[model samples]
Target: MFAKVIVDISHESIDKCFTYRVPTDFSLSVGDPVLIPFGRGKKKGYVIGIEELADFPEEKIKDILSPLEKEFSVEKQLLDLAIWMAEEYGTTLNQCLKTVLPVKKKTKNRTKPGKIQYGNPYPAPKLNAEQEEVLFAMQEYFQEEKVPSALLFGVTGSGKTELYLRLIEDCLSKGKEVIYLIPEISLSHQSRMRVEGRFPGQVAV
Candidate 1:
């Protein structure tokens, strides 16, 4: 098998992709982030595509070093979203990809790392009448085939976070992932901790 890798090099001249050989025993998927031998060093890249045949000679192609075991695979929807972002924002594809992909972190030692600290699950209180009505209305809106983006507005101290947690739980129950974005840096840490305590292992941050 052959894999067409989009190397992470930022040079305009080297922006185009290259093909690499895939070992027979190796299993790979599109959007899997991998390390590939590029010149004298290894560079991270993504398997944008895969093929059984290579345009170049078989001997010229290098094998992938390995997949980034700790990194999440890029979803096809995310790739499409990246392309759309590049065109919409007038940015390079690499820039867009970099924003969505995880950065490699260096560990100082080879010793086994400590496990992530997980907080106990948040104890959710029973919803009051108003909250229940709002939840049901939002759920009904989402049940439609062509649901539009939603905007929820409430004053400070409103049970917005509770509502969000409820919706997140519902989505998780259906095997769906959620992306929660916060505009303020000050709130990022607090929100992450709260969500972490609520969802525990289910959160990535």
Candidate 2:
């Protein structure tokens, strides 16, 4: 059997898959981590596919060295998402996988115990006619099976923040997570404070 492996090399040139021979007695599956020969050195790779035919010359095809920890293998759903990210962003698959398998950072301080305010809904703000129209249009996007994203554009002091808070409250009511992005660092602190005050323990800077 031939195994299509995506080697864990963070280079765009070698991001594509290479076929390797699977030993007769050896077992392999998608998302399994394996050691493979690349150049003179060996590197870890993810098994993305398996096939019966050998694309490369039979003599040139190499066998997988061994499987990495079976328990720690990457999940298939995550592997598919990584593949999608690589294609969509024009980046190496290994680079996407790096994000998928990011290193866990140790927290310097223990988190303070607090009540989760996730499902709690915030009070709705009164909106002008223009703001109400835009908000209702955006809300319809969320009501559909496939919610398409929207970009909100308004001049300064045009009640954009209020609209954002109202949408956040709507999402919170539906048990959905919200990500609010502030373009400027100067605005981040103020917006974060407002969100924290409104959402309490649920807000994360």
Candidate 3:
């Protein structure tokens, strides 16, 4: 038996689906991670399909080495989405997957002691009638199945950050992840400090 594996070469190069002969005792499945040799070096890829090709010469094909992952890292729907993205963006499926998946990192797990303390524990200023109405509207909008993109149009000292903090707190209470994007590096550092002070180990910059 032979399997067709899609291998990601490089960002600048296109991915190629190569057919490799599977050993009789080999146990392989679609989406199983496998290591295979390319032009000069070995690379990681995934098995997409399996079939017996009669036209190809048997001696030219290579055999798949041991698999990297025991199971598929992606689900079927997400895999289809990645394939569509690869075609639409003129990029390889591997690159599309890399962009969608979060970067895995090995970090020490440190549990924080007791209650977290915030340096700026100032109470949020009272919202005006207009602000209160806007907030209520936003709450309703977010309650829909999909969240629509929103723009906070306000000048300086408009209490935008305070509202953001309240939303973050609500999300945290529900066990959700929050990502904060800031334009300035200094502002990001300050925001990180404030979030860390409020949520301790739960908040990651």
Candidate 4:
């Protein structure tokens, strides 16, 4: 039995869905990356879905190449979120998906791992009384039942970065993922460098 599979197209194109025929022996699933012919060339994209169709002629569609990705790249919850974003932002689902996915970076140094490395080998400073109180508060908030958002408002040079690092460390120790946001590109770069230095090969900016 043949199935229709939808894939994303490259080149910042809005018309990203291209349907291909799933082979009889192939057991394909959503989120798998496949290479398929597009116009005169070929491109890589994730399999958005598969549908069984009874009426369409099978000879009209093309076959899918070997999938590049082992698992579904897009989670279902994230897909729902993307759909919501598309409706709210007046954009297509393909555009929203492109925005969420990481950009593919070409590299000559294939041996290097694609992760941030933190090499800060110096000792950390001792926490003051106020710093300790804030750290405790953060821990307490994390332990609560409700999802919480925090605003760290303080004057410049008030050790905000230090507090953030400690909070990140706490999250990591509890096997949680953390996303840090910065308002300025310069500050983002600085924070990325600091995280890379302290947690080499485990971070991504």
On lDDT, the stronger of 1 and 4 is: 1
How many residue-pair clashes does candidate 4 contain? 11
Ranking by lDDT: 2, 1, 3, 4
Report the C-alpha lDDT of model 4 over 1-205, residue by residue, as the tens digit.
Answer: 4333334642335434666877776766666667777668876666766777634566777788666664346665556666677779777776666665545664353334654434444245688898888888887887877866888777998777788888888888888766666788768656766776766555644
Put down candidate 2 lDDT per residue, 5-82, tens digits, no spaces: 998889878989999999997888898889999899999998999999997688989999888874346678778888
The deviation in Å at residue 92 for candidate 4 is 6.3
Residues 49-107, model 1: lDDT tens digits: 89988997888888988888777687887776766877798766666677766555653
TM-score-wise, the better of 1 and 3 is 1
Model 3: CA > 4 A from native: 49-59, 70-72, 108-139, 142-205
lDDT (C-alpha) at residue 200 in model 2: 71
| Span of 10 residues, lowest total lDDT, candidate 3 | 114-123
Please tell me which predicted candidate would have the highest TM-score against the true structure.
1
Q: Is candidate 2 or candidate 3 better by TM-score?
A: 2
Candidate 1 Cα deviation (angstroms), residue 182: 1.5
Candidate 1 positional error at 90, Å: 5.4
Order by TM-score, highest first: 1, 4, 2, 3
